[model samples]
Target chain A: MGGFLAGVVGACAEAWQEVRIHKGRVLLSLIGVAVAVCALSGAVAMSAIAQQATIEQADSAGGRAATLTMSMQPSDSTATGRQQATQAWFDVLDRYEISYASRVFWGSSRVQFPDSVQEAGMTVVDQPYGEMHRTRMVEGSWFQPGDSARLAPVVVINTPFWESLGSPDLATHPTVTIDGLGGAKAVIIGVYGTSSWDTWPSMFMLTGHFESLLDPVQAAGSMPQYEMWVPPDLARELQTRIQAELSGAVGAQGFVSVDRSDWGAQMDDPTTILRVITMVIGGIILLLGALSLVNIALVTVRQRIREIGIRRSFGATSGRVFFAVMMESVVATVVAGIVGVILAVLLVQSPMVSELVSFGGISDVPPFPASAAVFGLVVATVVGALAGLIPAIIAVRVKVIDAIRY
Target chain B: MSLIELTAVTRTVLIPDADPLTILDGVSLRVEPGERVSIVGRSGSGKSTLLNLLGMLDLPTTGELSFEGESVPAMKPGRRDRVRGSNVGFIFQQFNLLDGRTALENVTMPLLYARGPRFWGRERIAADILDRVGLGHRLSALPGSLSGGEQQRVAIARALVRQPKLILADEPTGALDVETGQSVMTLLDEIVREENAALVTITHDPAIAARSDRHFRLDRGVLTVAEGAARNAGRADEPVTDGPVADDAVAVL
Candidate 1:
């Protein structure tokens, strides 16, 4: 064991000396490898951020992972029929002990404008809706549990809706009037930012307040869908169990259907697709880098024929010579790999890069993945090993007599 | 036992789409410990091939070969290489000094493969040997920065650093002027005597051949003892003549 360790240490020292002697040539090859590793590592790190942005985007559209949405059709178009459906919703929630769930109603609310009254999109939801959807707020706060007890409706408006109302200060208790529905006043408690795809004015309201403003006939016509956040592990099994349980709970007064509505349940998950695409591109980049490195290493070995012969003539065995040649390349690339990883970390963590990769949406970009940096170094070592093989073989095959003569 | 022995040793090479070429024909030679033997041959007369054979760099096509009573041909390549490394030291006409290394580093090459104290104290051993060769001041000098004689002395330091049983000097003085050549040769001979190690000098120089204890001439792949090839103690080459460095060189050794 001691002899083996000595041999390895000796070979490494010799390799380092050779690398230092040929630094000019080593530097050029290392440049190619460094750039390749940087690009590959950056792509991996960026993918992590892209994945977070994609998840939040999906959460906004279809809610978080494992969120099941429930919808019901009433036996009759009457206020009592809708109330019975809502009662069934209450019973199921109480029985399951689920905490994060909300019933969402989609409609438009009449707003009093300076010149005339206009209709803006509105959603009637319970308090848990904003938290479940990762709703980004530009001002004020999301709906609180006590919001249900307010005499006047409390609403969260999007930027455009707030702009239509002159972007008022929430501390002053800004209110928008319901022009067509008995002229009811609604407090604008918060302003939520809009995604790039969203431009139209929209607002959110608590279910009780929205019902208080709109008449029973109109409230009965608005479609309400059930959503609840549950443990992802139990989602599939619970999805199956909920379908049967809810069907029985609502009984013959309504037809109920339950389905997993998160973007993850859908067939085309953009985040997974992004990861696969990045890996394929990164792989191609590394391969090109390795090929160039191998070419340069082969040329360098050919130039050192006499050196190899001298080492052999002294007492260097085939294994020692082979390992030394290979270690030279390995040492050079590992140093390059470290440089590349550092470059990648700095670039990925930079503000402009983070914003660009997240599409300007992800305020909390995920921390640089430690796994990505480790992956880069590991891959560089592997590439160095592979690139060194042919050159090492050529070096060991140098006949001592021929090399000395040359 | 002889330090190295070759009986009826032959070396042949086969070329693609051509007849086999014979470089050495049934050469036989033996040298005991502490003996100095020289072989002289014209260019391409198989002196190098014979030197390579004796150095274990090439296998004999057919023959009995032994180093200190161990059959060299029967050893594994790895074992044979180890035997060669531990027992034989080679000095080239061109010096073959590694270009970018210091004189001390060049001398440390053979010791890198050595185990125990030799490997650990390689630099010190190298420095000591360079000091013996009158190159102690040039230990840090690269081969390119050194003169021809200085570079050859560094090569000699490299060869002897391991203190091997046999030293093979292939045309060791072919690249130097006559006086410097004799100076280097005399230095080499005295060191081999001090170390009590066998020496084989392969050269075409008659004066260099005359300095050895015994001499053989190689002609067209055949070995024969030349007339008047025996070592003579009072040879004209030994008196230094007008060569100032010879006195210095021999005196240092």
Candidate 2:
């Protein structure tokens, strides 16, 4: 066993020396391998970013996974009836210890500037909406525990909306006056970053605070819907329970409908197709790279025929000669793999790639995955072994007498 | 016991569309431990074929050959390789030093397959042998940087690094100048004697052949020793019994 290990170590060292001696040719032959590994690992790293973008898109359209969104259309869907329905939904949410819940209501607020008035887009949400949607606060903070206890309704406005309000400082407790809230003032408690679609001014206010000052005609046109987050495994059962309980509380038979927002299912269909496409492309690149490597290794072995003969005469067995030749390719490719992976990290983790992926939306760039690096190196070694096989056999078949004659 | 013995060793090659060509016909020789023997031959003679057989690089057809009392033809190829690696070393006419390797690295090549502490301490052993060959200062020099005689000296160091029982020199100084050839031969003779190893030198020069303890000639695929050369040698106790002995006009050593 010791001798076997020594043989392996000696062969590896000799292989490294051979590579160093012929580095120019080795580097030329290794270009294909380096490019293949770079592309493969880069694709792997980008997949994570792609997946995150898919989840974010799904979250914006529907909601995150394990979230149950309930909607109802009752015969007596009056303002008072809607208030009763919301209260009953809240009771059910509190009973289940559902920490995240929001009633999404879109409305336009009449914001009065110093010189003129403008109608700006506003979203009414509970505190958890900020976290569930991966919203980042640019200043101050999301709704705190005592935020709802303040006299004026606290609203988190985007940068554009804040700028429309003359860029008031949050430290001085800036306020804005709205038309429909009986000329009441709204406090700007926090400022959040803007998305690409948020061209106009936008603000996020508490559901109850917005509802208190909402216009009845506007509320009638767009009804508020309740969404809540729960554990994924318990989502289906809880959805059924919530439907039954909300129907009983509101006395609205066949009106309540509960559905789960499955982000994983939304992600699987398209991403699986993407994954297959990626594999096909990566496999072709690797195949071409292997073919190139095989060609170069064949030529290299042919050129080293005399050297092989000399080594055999000096006590190297045919097996040793074969192994030494094969290991030269293996060692060279492994080093190239390391270089390619480092290049991949630099390429995939760059700010330009992140900017391209985010598209000025929510910046949710994930860390470069370690699996990609491992996969690249393992594949490189396997490719090296496969490429070197035929050449090593040819080298082993060389006759010592014929080679010495040369 | 003799370090190597060949009885009626014959080597034949089959060519396409032609009859089998006999390369070596009934060649017989024996070298005891620490003995020096030489074989002089013409260009097309069977000297190299016999040398290849003695070096264990090729097996004889329809002949009995043994090294240190072990049958060479009966051993497996892998076992033969091990025996040859551990017990036999060769010096080629071209010096045959690896192109890009240093003198120390070339010398350490054989010790990679040796057994015991010698395998583990190969670098030290190679360095000591290179120094003994007066190449200690040129340990890091490649073969291209060294002259013909210096490269042959490195080749000799490589051959002796394993301390084998038998060293086969196939025209060791064939590529060198006369003066350099003599000096390289002297170095080889001194090293072999100091190490107590048997030496088999195949040469085309009569002067080189005359320096050995015993001299033989190979002509037209047949080996013949000069008259009365083997009579005073120590191996006369054994006589040819397995194959046809040479005629009275020729003595087989």
Which 10 successive residues of model 1 chain A have the least lDDT summed?
A245-254
Residue A392 lDDT in candidate 2: 91
Best by DockQ: 1
Q: Count the backbone clashes (under 3 Å) in each candidate.
A: 0, 0
lDDT of 2: 0.80
The collision pairs in model 1 are none
Give the residue spans of candidate 2 off by over 4 A: A109-119, A138-140, A158-185, A191-201, A216-222, A252-254, A267-270, A361-364, B227-253
Compared with the true structure, what per-residue lDDT tens digits does model 1 show for residues B120-234?
A: 8888999999999999998889999998999888988888889988999999988999889889988998888998989999987778888777667677777766446544323
Cα displacement (angstroms), candidate 1, residue A64, comes to 1.4
Reference-based TM-score, model 1? 0.90
Residue by residue across A1-406, what tens digits does model 2's lDDT show?
8778778877887888899888887897688899898888888777767767666766765677777888865545677777677788878878999988888877777887677888878888888887776666778788986776676798898888888777887999988887756677888889887656777987888876876676776566555778888888888799889988888766644278888765743435546666667667888888898899899888888888888877776677888888988899899889878888998899988888865655554546688889989999999998888888999999889987667666
